[model samples]
Target: MRAVIADGKGGPEVLKVVDLPVPKPGPGQLLIKVRAAGVNRADVMQRQGLYDPPDGNAVLGLEVSGEVAGHGPGVTAPPIGTKVVALVASGGYSEYVAAPAGQVAPAPEGVDLVDAGGIIEVAATVWSNVFMIGQLQKGQSFLLHGGASGIGTMALQLARVAGARIATTVGSDSKVKIARALGADLVINYREEAFEEVLADHGFVPDLILDVVGAAYLRRNVEILGVGGRLVVIGLQGGQLGEMPIGNLLYKQGSVHATSLRARTLEEKRSIVRATTDALWPLLASGTVRPVIAHRHRLAEVSEAHRAIEDPEHIGKELLVVH
Candidate 1:
C-alpha cells in the first residue's frame, strides 16, 4: 500500500508518499480500504516533529472514510464491504489502515462517502470533550476557539442543535460570517477584537469552552468562566506551557482539562465514537448539521493538503482522496 509520512521532521516539503506493506488488522480491528482521509493540524505537528504518534505508528492521518475489507480476530458485525468512517490512532494516510472495531461507525446516511472522511474525528472530539466531559446544556453559553476550523465548525453546529447559545472566535471577517451562518450566536474576530472583552460586553459568561489554542488562552479562558464552568483544552497550536490562574478558577469553581483524542486508549475511543454516532449521526443525515470541507487533494498531492490546512485563509476540513 502507498502511505504518506514525514521523511524528516520539518515543513510540508518533508512529507513523502512511499510504498509500505499493507497493515494487517490486529485483535478486534477492521481493515479499511481507504477512500479518503482527513487532514488535520496534528498531522502538521507530526511532520514538524512536535507531536509523535501513539505506539510509534508513523503514518499521518487521524480519520478516514472507507469500505471494510477484512476483520481481525473476534470482529464480525459490520461485515466486509460495509461503508464506514473511522477515527484512527494513526496510519489513515494510506491505501489501507487497521482501525480498532469500536472506533468504526457506519457512514451517516445522505452524506457523500468521500466527505464522510472528515466527520468522525471532529464529531468524536466535540462529543467527548464538549458534551460528555464539559456537560454543556441547553440555554448555557458555550465559547469555542477557532470557529472556522474543522473542530470549530462541527462544534458550532452540534452546540446549536443542543440548544446552547454559542460564541466563537475566528481570525477573519469571512470566517466570522461562516461561523455565524453555522449557528454561533456570537462571533469574534480575535485578530481585531479581544474575545474575552467581546463576550463580556455581551454578558456572556461561558458555561463551557472548547479551546484549541492552549497556553495563550488559558488565563483569559479561566477569568471569564461562569460558576462551575468547564474549560476543555484539546489542542496546543499556540504553545504548550501556561500558568493556571488558580485563584480565579477556585472562586468560580471552574475545572480545566487538557485532552487529546489521538493518544486515548482503544476502549475510550470506542466509547466516544459510539456516543458521537448515536447523538450526531441523525442530524448529519437529515442535514440539520454537516461537515464543512475546504479542499480535497489526491493522495499523491498530500503535501498540498498539508499546506492547505496550515493556510490562514483555510476553513473547515481538508481531505486527501486515496482511491
Candidate 2:
C-alpha cells in the first residue's frame, strides 16, 4: 500500500508518499478500502512536528470514507461491502485503513463515499466538545471561530439543527455569505472589526463557544462568554500561548473545556461515533446538514493540497482521493 508517512520531526516535505505494508485490523476492528480521506489541521501539525501520531505510528490522516472490505475476528456490525466512513485515531492516509468497529458508521443513505470523507472526525469532534462538553442547549447562542473552515461549517450546521442560534467569525464577506447560507444567524469579519463588539451589537454574548483559534481568542472570548457560558477550545490555529483572566472567568462563571481528538482513547472515540450516528445521521441523510468540500486532490499530490490549506486563503474542506 502507498501511504503518506511522516519523518519523526520535520515540515510537510517529510510527508512523502512511500510504499508501506498494508495494515491489518485486530480484534473488534474492521478494514476499509479507502475511497477518500479528509486532510485535517492535525495532520498538518503532525507533518510539521507540532503534533505526534500515536506511539510507533507515523501515518497521518485521522478520518476516511470508504467501503468495508473485511472485519476483524468477532466483528459483526458493518458487514463486508458496506459503504461506510470511519474515524481513526491514526493511520488513515492510505489505500486501506483499519479502525475499531465502533468508529465505523454506514454512510448516510445516499451520501457518496468520496463526499463522506469529510464527516466522521468533524462530526465527532463538534458533537463531543461543543454539544456535549459545552452543554450547548437549544435556544442558546453558540459562536464558532472559523466560519468557513471545515470544522466551523460543520459545527454551524450541527448547532443549527440542534436548535441553537448560530454565529461565526469569518475572514471575508464571501465567507460571511457562506456562513449565513449554512444557517448561521450572524457572521463577523474578525479582520476588519472586533468580534466581541459585533456579538454585542447583535445581542449575542454567546452561551457557548466552539473555538478554533486558541490563545488568540483567549482574551476576547472571555469578554463574549456570557454568564455561565461554557467554552470548549478545540483548536490552536492561533498561537498556543497566552494568559487568560481568571477574575473574569470566576465572575462570569465561565467554564473551559479543551480537548485534542487524536490523543483520545478508542472507547471515548466510539462513544462519540455512536452519539453522532444516533443524533446527527438523520440530519445528514435528510440533507439538513452537509459536508462542505472546498477542493479535492489526488493522493499523490498531497503536498500540493497541504500547501493550499496553509496558504491563509483556502476555504472549506481539503480532501484527498485515496482509492
Candidate 3:
C-alpha cells in the first residue's frame, strides 16, 4: 500500500509518498481500504514537528472514509465491505488504515462516501465540546472563531439545528457571506472590527464560545462571555501562553476548558463517537447539516492539499482521495 510520510519536520514540501506494507487491525479494530482522507490543521502541525503522532503511528491523517475490508478479534456488525467513516489518531493518509471498531460509524445515508471523511472529526469535536462539555442548551447563544473553517462551519449548522443563536468571526468580508449561509445569525469580519465590540453593540453575549485561537483571543473572549458562560479551547493556532483574567472569570462566573480529541484514551473517544452519531447522524441523513468541502486532491498530491489549507482564501475542509 502507498502512504504519506514526513521526510523531516518542516513545511508541506516535507510530505512524501511511498509504498509500505498494509497495516493489520489490532483487537477490536477494523481494517479499512481507504477511499478518502480529511486533511486537518493537526496534520500540518505534525508535519512541522509541533504535534507528534500517538506512540507508534507516524502517518499524518486523523479521519478517513473507506470500506471495511476485514476485522480483528471480537469485532463485527460493521461487516466486511460496509462503507464507513472513522475517527483515527493517525495513519489515515494511506490506501489502508486500521481503526478501532467503536470509532467507526456507518457513512450517513445520503452523503457521498468520499466526502464522508470530512464529517468525523468536525462532528465529534463540535458535539463533544460544545454540547457535551460546554453544555450549550437550546436558545443559548454560541460564538465560534474561524467561522469559515471546517469545524466552525459544522458547528454553525449543528447549533442552528439545536435552536441556538450562532455568531462567528471570520478573516474577511467574503467569509461573512459564507458563514451566514451556514446559519450563523451574526458574522463579524475580524479584520474590519473587533468581534467583542460588534457583539456588544448587538447585545449578544455568547453563552458558549468555541475557540481555536488561544493566547491571541484569551482576554477578549472572557470579556465577551455572558454570565455563567463556558469557553472551550480546542486548538492553539496562535501562541499557547496567555495570562488568565481570573478577575473577569470570577465576576462573570465563567469557566474555561482546554481539550484535544487526539490525545484521549480509546474508551473516551468511543464515547464521543457514540454520542455524536446518535445526535448528529439523523441531521446528516436528513440533509439538515452537510460536509463543506473546499477542495479535493489525489493522495499523491498531499503537499498541494496542505498548501490549500494554509491558503487564507480556502474555506471548509480539504480532502485527499486515496483511490
TM-score versus the correct structure, for each prediction:
0.99, 0.96, 0.98
RMSD of each: 0.8, 1.4, 0.9
| Better structure of 1 and 3 per lDDT | 1
On the 0 to 100 scale, the lDDT of residue 38 in model 3 is: 98
**Model 3 per-residue lDDT tens digits across residues 179-241:** 999999999999899999999999999999999999899988998889999999999987899
User: Among these predicted structures, which one has the highest lDDT?
Assistant: 1
Candidate 3, after superposition: displacement of residue 31 in Å? 0.4
Which residue pairs in candidate 1 have backbone atoms (N, alpha carbon, C) closer than 3 angstroms, thus clashing? none
Off by over 4 Å in 2: 8-11
Question: Candidate 2 residues 1-323, lDDT tens each?
Answer: 98888755666566788888877788999999999999889988888888877754788898998999888888976778888989987788899988889889888765677988878898888888887798888899898889788888888888888899988889888888889998899888889998888888888888999888899889888877999998888888898996798899999998888898777888888888999888888988788888888888998888877887886666778888998
* Candidate 1 C-alpha lDDT tens digits along 71-109: 999998798999999999889999999999999999999
Give the whole-model CA lDDT for all candidates, comma-separated: 0.93, 0.85, 0.92
The per-prediction tally of clashing pairs is 0, 0, 0
